[model samples]
Target: MSQYFHSVTLNKEKCKGCTNCIKRCPTEAIRVRNGKAKIIKERCIDCGECIRVCPYHAKKAVTDPFENIYNYKYKVALPAPTLYGQFKNVWDINLILTGLKHIGFDDVFEVARAAEIVTLATKRIINSKKLQKPIISSACPAVVRLITVRFPNLVKNVIPIQSPMEVAARMVKRNISKKMGYKTEDIGVFFITPCAAKVTSSQIPIGLDTSLVDGVISMKEVYLKLVPILDKIDHVENLSCAGMIGISWANSGGESTALENEQNIAVDGIHNVIKVLEELEDEKLSDINFVEALACTGGCVGGPLTVENNFVAKNKITRMAKLISNTAVNDISNTLETVDVSWTNPITYKPILNLDNDMIKAMKKMESLEKIYNDLPGLDCGSCGAPSCRALAEDIVRGFANETDCIFKLREKVRGLAREMMELEGEMPPPFRKNEE
Candidate 1:
C-alpha cells in the first residue's frame, strides 16, 4: 500500500490551476504547481472541501465499484441515514431498505440503529466524569483527523468510541456469520457512504488498526440504481429498527440532542469547526462539556458525494424521522456486551508541522521561515500557489519553493537587474560595446 491513502484526488487534465480549492481547504493541503493543483497527502484530512469547490470538476472521490457486493456469498448493506435524504418524497425509511434488496443486497442493516448504541456509550462516559473536560465527538472522521493534524493538544480531548459505521459493520458480520454457520471471510459488510472522508476512513482507519467494513459504496452511485426500482416494489419490509433519536443523526445537532446535555455545543462546516477548535485551544470553552464538530455543513446530508441539495436533504431527514416516530426504537442497552464500541488504539497527533526531528535544527528553520515571510508581500493572493504568504515562506525553507516564486518578489529582482545592466554599459571595453548609429 502507499504511505498515505486518500480518497479525494486531483484530475490533472481537468484542472485549470485555479486557486479556488487552496483558499477553502481548512488544512492548507493544496498547492498549484506546474499549472495544476496538487494535494499534499500528509496534510489532507479528506474533508471533501476541495471536491466541492473545484469548478472544473477536477477533483473526485474514489469508492468501491457497485459490483463488489456480489463478491461475497451473503451480501449485506449498512445504509447510512444520509442515504434516505438522497431520495424524494420517501416517507418511510423501511421503503428505502427494501429497495436495496431488489438491486443486489441480500440483507440491510440501518446505521442509525448502530448510532443509538454509540449514543448510550457516550452518555455513560459523560456520567463517569473522567478524562479532560469538553470531550470531543469522534463521529466525523474528517474532524478527528483535523484535530490530529492541526490541534495536536486537543487529541486527548477526543472521545475514544468507534463511529457508527464501524459498529454497524461489526454487528452485521457477527450476526450473519454465527447464525448462518458461515466463515467471517465469506460475509462482506459494505457501508453506503455520503462523503470522501468515510471512503478513506474505512480503508485507513482513524483510531482502529483495521476497519471491519469490507467496502464503501458512494450514496450517489447507489441512488442511481434505486431511482427506477423504488416505485416498482410491491411490498416494503419492516427492516428499519431505529428511532427518531437515531435517525436525527443525518443533520447537525442530532448527536448533541441525543446526549440531552445542555452544556454541549454543535458546529458544522469545515471552517466553522476550525474556529471552535481554536477557541478550545485558547481555553475559552472550558465550561462546555462536549463539542460536536462535523466537517460538512448540515452534517452528512451536505456531503459532496450526495445528490440532493443540502437544504432539501435536511428537510427530508427531519420529516422522515417524524413520520416514523410512532414506531418503537430497538433497545440497544444489551449491545455493549455483544460488540466492542470503544477504540482499541488511541488517536495520536500526526506530526506534519515539524521542520526537523532535532529541536535545534527545527528552531533554526523557524527563524529562516520568519525572515523569508517578512520579505514577501503580505497579500495572500495565491499567485505563488501556496495558500498564504507564510505558507510560501515555509515551502522555501523546506526547499520545495524559491523566494522568487512570489510575483512581487520576482518583480523586485527584475528591476534591480535592469538598473545594473544600464550601469555596466558605461564600463564595457571598446570592442565589446555596441557601435553608435
Candidate 2:
C-alpha cells in the first residue's frame, strides 16, 4: 500500500539544476535531471533540508492555508516546543501566544507541556522490553522516515510512542472540547512548525493511523506576518504553562535536561544522530541511561524557519532555560498516571523498505542495472535527475528511471562524431598505400 500526503513539494519551474539538495539530503532521496530536481516519493524523509539549502528557494512544503482555520468554529494554535526559540531577547512567552490570537487564532497551547508528559511516558517505554535494543526516538518524523527507507534494519530500534506533536494535539482537543463545550470536530488545532517533517508527521503520522493535529503552518511564513506586530500584542508576565525543562525542548540537550536522569545523553544534527543510533544498534549505548536525538543541528534553533541565526538563538535559549525554575518531569508522570496519556492512535509495524522481503526480484533488478550502468559514461552529473551516476543506475533498476534519463548519453554521441572524423583522415592515406601495393 502506498501512503502519500501533501507535505514536501517541488517547485519545478524555479529549480536551477543545483546539486545543493542532493548533497544535503540525509536519505539521498532527490535526483537532478534535465536541469530540474525531483523527489523519490518513497525515499523522501521530508526533512526539508532541501528547502533550506536551495539557492532558488525552489523546494516548497505543502500546507493548509491559514484561512483553512475557518473550517472549524474554534481554532487553536498548538505551537511546537521549537517555535518558542524563534523569538530572541523576548523573555515573555505570552507575546508570541497572544500574537497568535491577533493573527486569527482563537487560542494557543504549548507543545512543551506535551513534551513534559511525553518525557514521562517515554521513560516507561525505555524501562519496558517490548522493543529491540537501543530504541530510537520517534520524535522527528524525518528521522523515523529515514529509518523506514534507508535503514529498515533499524526500525526495530524505533520507539513506538507517538511524537509530542501528536500527543499535544490530543491533549489540546481534549482540554478545549471539554472546557469550552465544543465538539472535537469544531476545534481545529494547527501546529506552528519549524520544519517540513513536522508537517509530514501531521499528515501521515508515524505511529498513528490518523493525526490529531488538524493543520500545520510554517514558522517562516507565520514569522513574516508576526514580526510586524510584536509590540502591539498585549503582554502578560507569565503566560507560559511550561517550566524550564519544557522550554529546553528547543535545544539538543533538552531531552536529557528534562529527563534529568544523570545518565542521559542528547544528540543533535542528522549525521550525529544517525551515528549514535548506529552505536546503539551495536549495544554501545547500554551504559547510557537515555538518548535524545534531533535531526537539525542545535535542535529547533537550526530549523528552516526564523530569521535569527541558530547559534545566536541557541545562546538565548540556554540563558532562558537557566532562568526558569527546574521542575521534575516525574511530577508530570505522577499526574498523568492512568490518565490515558498513551498513544490514542493505532500503531503499525510494517517496514517501509521491505528489506527482508524476497531478494530474488531485487537480485534480477540489480543484475540488469549493472549492464545499463556499464553502457553509460559514469558521470555523476545531475543531468540524469539522479544525485549521481550510481544513483541513476539504481533508479533505473528500481523502475523509477529510464535509459534517456542521462544527458551525458547525448554528449557521448558528439564524442563518437569526433572519433569518426579522425578515422576518415586515416582512410584517405590508406587508399594511397593500396595503389602502391
Candidate 3:
C-alpha cells in the first residue's frame, strides 16, 4: 500500500535526468535512475520542493479538475488568504470573493475567516499551557507530514488542531445546510489552494477520519478565470470578513504574529523549518512557547501551485491587511463550540529510517550501510543518482544500487580489474595466454 497519497508527481517524458531534484529534496526521496527521476513515495511529504527545482517541468502537482466542482448540486468556493496577494491592484477581498460566484460558484467562503477563528482557538490553547512547550503549528500539511516521517521524535510537539481549510469547509457545509435546506452531501466545498500539500490534505486528511473539503482547485487556475471577469464586475459582496491577523497568514510569520506571543518563533522554507525542528527536538529552545513553521519560502505565496512571485505576494498581503483596517472581525470562541476544530485522532510517528522490519536484520543492514558510507567519497556530488553519498550507501545496503554506481568507485573497480588481469596473465596456461612473442 502507498504510505501517503501524494499529489506531487513526476513526468518521466520531460525529465532530463538532472540532479536538481535529487540534490534539493530535503528528505532525499528522489533519485535519478535510467535517465528519469523517481520519487520514493513513503519519504515524500508533497512539499513541492521537487516541483520547484525541476527545470524541465517534469515535477507537477496534480489538483482536481476545475470542472470537478460541478459534480454537486451546489458549489461553494473556499478561497485562501494567499489568493488576495495574486491580484496586483485589487485591494478589496470582496471583489475576489464575488468574482468566484460570477464564475459558476453558488457561494464563496473565505478560508481566512476560518483562520481568524483558529487564531482565537490557538491563543486559548497557548494560555492553557496544556501542550508541550514550543508547540508546532499544524497549519502546513507538508510540514506536518515531514515531521511524521523524518522528525518522528517531535510528533508530540505538533498541536492537534484542524486546518483552516477544513474548518472553512465544515462551516460552509453547516451554514448552507441549515439556511438553504440543502443536504450536506449535495453541497460541494472546493478549496482554491495555493499549494500541492493542500490537495493531498483535502483528499486524505492527517488527523481527521475524512476531510470536509469536496475538492481542491489551484489558485493559478482560479486566477486565470478571475482576471477575465474582475474588470467587468460592477457589484461586490460584503463577503470579506476575515481581519488583519487572519489575512496575514499568507506570509511567513503571520500565524506567530497572530498569537501575539513574544516568545514564539516563526520560520518558513522547508529547509529552515527542518533546522528549527532539529533544535526543538534537541530541547535547545526550551524558552519558546510556539513554533510556526511554513514549508514554502514566503509562506503560502511561495507554494508551487501559485502564480505570483513570493516577495511581491507577501508585500500585497501586508498592504491589503492595512487597506481594509479590519480587526479580528468577531470573537470566535462561540464558533469553536459550534464547529469541531480539534483533531479527531492523535498524530503518530511514521518513521522511514529503519532498514528492515526485523530488528537483527535491520541492525546488520545498518552496520553494512555504515561501512559502505565510510568507503564513499563524502562529496555528496549526486552523481550516483542518490542525493548524497550516505543516501547511495543506504541504497546499496537496501539492494537498490551498487558500489560501482558511483563514478569514483567505478574507477577504483576498473583499476583493480586491470591489476587482476595483469597478475592472471603471468600465471595463465600457455595456449590461452596472449604473448608478445
lDDT of 2 by residue, 14-52 (tens): 999888888777777788766788786867778778878
Runs off by more than 4 Å, candidate 3: 1-3, 327-330, 422-428, 431-437
- List, in order, the clash count of every candidate structure: 0, 3, 0
Clash pairs detected, candidate 3: none
Residues 350-398, model 1: lDDT tens digits: 8898887888988999999999999989999999999999999999988
lDDT of 3 by residue, 1-437 (tens): 24468899998899999999999998889998898998998888999998999899999999999999889999999999999999988887899999999998999988988998888888878889898888999999999999998887789889899999999999999999999999999999999999999999987798998999999999999999999999899988888778888899999889999888899899999999999999999999999999999999999989998888999999999999887655533556678889989999899988577789899999999999999999999999998999999999999989999999999999999999999999986796778778649
lDDT of each: 0.91, 0.75, 0.91
Q: Which ten residues in a row have the lowest lDDT in candidate 3?
A: 324-333
* Range of the 10 consecutive residues with the lowest summed lDDT in candidate 1: 322-331
Candidate numbers sorted by lDDT from highest down: 1, 3, 2
Candidate 1, after superposition: displacement of residue 417 in Å? 1.0
Whose TM-score is greatest here?
A: 1
| Clashes, model 3 | 0
